[model samples]
Target: MFAGDSDLSLTSIDLFCGAGGLTLGLENAGFLSVMGLDTNRDAMATYRKAFPDAEAVEGSIAGYDFGQWRGVDLVAGGPPCQPFSNGGKRLAAKDNRDMIPEFARAVNTIMPRAFIMENVAGLLAPRNREYMAEILSLFSDRYTILPPRLINAADYGVPQKRMRIVLIGLLKGSIDFPAPTHLPGRYVTSGSVLRRGETQGYSNPSKIVYARRPDLRPSPYAGQLFNGGGRAINLDLPAPTILASAGGNKTHFIDELHAVIPYHKHLWDGGKPRSGELEGGRRITILESAMLQTFPTEMEFAGSRSSQYTQIGNAVPPRLAEVIGASVARALN
Candidate 1:
């Protein structure tokens, strides 16, 4: 396992480990990742590249053996959450992709001292209260289940307003939720991200063509923030949630001039929104998305563009994960 000066002896195994975001954060905060598991070959490949010392395995969680991870210090993951995503069919536990039961089983088998599972806030919607109760009951007896807290990435120094429900359970005792490290109005803003100018593939021909298209009209398919109807990103503040499916019209950048910019622009702010001028509404690049998730700017992503975006968007922000990890470290020590 990757060891550090902190000499943290605790080890962890990550289930559904997409691109190693949680693993990276936990490692930064002292827990070494012994293994990372996921079914997505490309994402697992990227995880391997990022964490050369850790084992990255590909398989369905239900069929995988938890025996190898038994006696580990912690088990951490964010299971496939499409069933609980607001953008998806809210099937809750009925969605075959729902992996909470499998996760619960793994935790039971591994019998780790603690575990942290993250998912969309929609999982706790009133309609899914019973499902939430059932899942919590699985750990309540042997573990002190901390209240599932809604954690916003922006509150932890990430550049986006993404919110995920974090459930931390300890074998014995309780964990205090990490306090918000950043307050409103002090967040990293979209405008700042735009100014960086270092994102890969930012100048692709196709993207430039789409971004400069002056004839595109607003449609329902567009994200509300980009459709010129709902709220646009407050560029001076943190961005709205960056989506896994962001493309074309789904999300747009609004500039200081009150003009709607698509993700296909040549210049970052679409060049002052002038009529008959080359316009800007280019999509946020993969690197920018990763930044919003607070991945180190120098971190390497080894996947296709779409796969990279999926991994970045689906990840638990490393900033937030570090906070959780530090808390876990304190509680464990």
Candidate 2:
């Protein structure tokens, strides 16, 4: 936790708050989360449950009034990123789902002492650069916008290699981005949080579509044996980015033996699974996914299995958020 004067305390409001990941982190960092806002029913339910003292409002951010929260010490959120996501159409401001402008509008209206916004790295893609410039202009009159930084959750001790762009703006104070707490070879690994023996009631992949075993590559990031967006996990290293599209064949696979099987052409000489060949593996469970995202073990997600996965995948790792929140709190103090 970032220490401040004896009476230093700050209040925050989280917009686009899905399942309260940022709220949880800020709370852990000594900020009082006064309110949360989101459109997903299940996500709002989870947020309300997690932070019962805070008011969790359910609605779209477009045209939402921030008049009542005019003096919140911090305003933070991850607006819908589908429009600027690499996997999406990249419509940017043209896409109806693009909520960056709304986020800016909220910041300008509330005029918080400081604000933090996180989104997919694709937001800085060449195609969306112009649109991003326009959004930054919205805060020029009131806040000093810091250079956006591409941050990896693993650098902050999250067990996944998820990366996102983080932007910070301050109305009248100076703040720096949080420094990495862990280095490359010292990263926390997925194996440290997951175990093969703990897969009792968790779901498994409908089918194992191994194109082939891992090749004799020199890099620790080499083994990608699955067919969909998912890949084979290197237990010794951080897991690949967890996707919101979980509970399907695209979900990441784990080698039960904890060994990366060597490439064997005969295993699938024709690019299809052999009739008599088999391997020991299973898709990661929702709980495991949450663990990888660095969510608290006892935090209950209120939704269907798929909705729960979406909540976990979409969350900013609470650990990473706490680091950022500490920095913001120090600036405020």
Candidate 3:
């Protein structure tokens, strides 16, 4: 397990702080999270439950006072990424959900020794390049911002192939991104964290819909196997990104008999199951999703089932965050 220097305890304030994923990771790295801020009531409840000692404040980041948090060693968050998410409208800067500017505002006001901003990889697309440049310009004068890097959660042992863009800014010194602990051939697989036959309470699709589009064909690596947004998961490999839209029919499905059925082949003898026929696969449960996201087994999420799924899906993957936090702690120490 990665451990930070126990002698030097750093501090941080999580801005978006959904369910305390980043906060949990940083705490594991020996940083004390003093406060967490967010707007979702359910997320705040989860965050509070996870970090009871830390103040969990519910409110929008916009117009919120960050000056009070001045001198915090680090200010970190994954701002709302709906604007740049591939699953969303891809509105870029035009979307009302865009919160990069608010994140920059918090960093500038807090003037922390360093700041880490996480967002979807789509932010780097050519269409959003100019908007991203504008967002970075907000911090150029105050901090030494590193070139944004796209990081894969699987590289850090998270059992999901989640990719995100991370931007680190330092006030004085340089810090390198954490090196991948697990390589391609040895990546931690879904089977490492997820258990078999744990689908008791979770719902499965009524009828399985196979992808007819050639472009959606399942590949050796990843692809859409079903018609819904859910992707097929290979037990021996990292699962595809667990989306925020889970807890519904769109949630990714797993087939214990994948080796037998394989790819797009039907479970029945000749064709797709009739309408209302129970699909022979199971969608992952809330606890299973949290486990796949690398949350502690004891971690309890508050709020509705949908909200819990969203919190888990939107989290930074505590394992990945811990790796990043360790790097940051090393730089600070």
| lDDT measured at residue 72 in model 2 versus the true structure, 0 to 100 | 81
- Candidate 1 per-residue lDDT, tens place, 154-198, comes to 888788888899999998766788898888877767677755334
Which portions of model 3 show Cα errors greater than 4 Å? 1-8, 200-223, 259-279
lDDT of 2 by residue, 197-266 (tens): 5673367655556544433244424544455666667788899998998777667767775433443343
Model 2 TM-score, all chains together: 0.90
| Deviation (Å) of 50 in candidate 1 | 0.3
C-alpha lDDT values of all predictions: 0.74, 0.82, 0.81
Model 2 CA deviation exceeding 4 Å by range: 1-8, 211-224, 258-260, 264-278
Per-residue alpha-carbon lDDT of model 3 for 1-333, expressed as tens digits? 012323467889998998999999999987888899999899999999889888889999999988778778889999999999988999987898989888998888888888899999999989988988998998748698888999899999999999999999988888888889999989999988665665634454434455555233336334544556665577889988988888776677766555324433543334443333225566777887898999988889999888888999989998988999889888887
User: Ten-residue segment with the worst summed lDDT in candidate 3?
Assistant: 269-278
Model 3 has a clash total of: 0
**Residue 114 accuracy (lDDT) in model 2:** 92
Each candidate structure's TM-score, on Cα atoms with residue i matched to residue i, is 0.83, 0.90, 0.90
10 residues in a row with least lDDT, candidate 1: 204-213
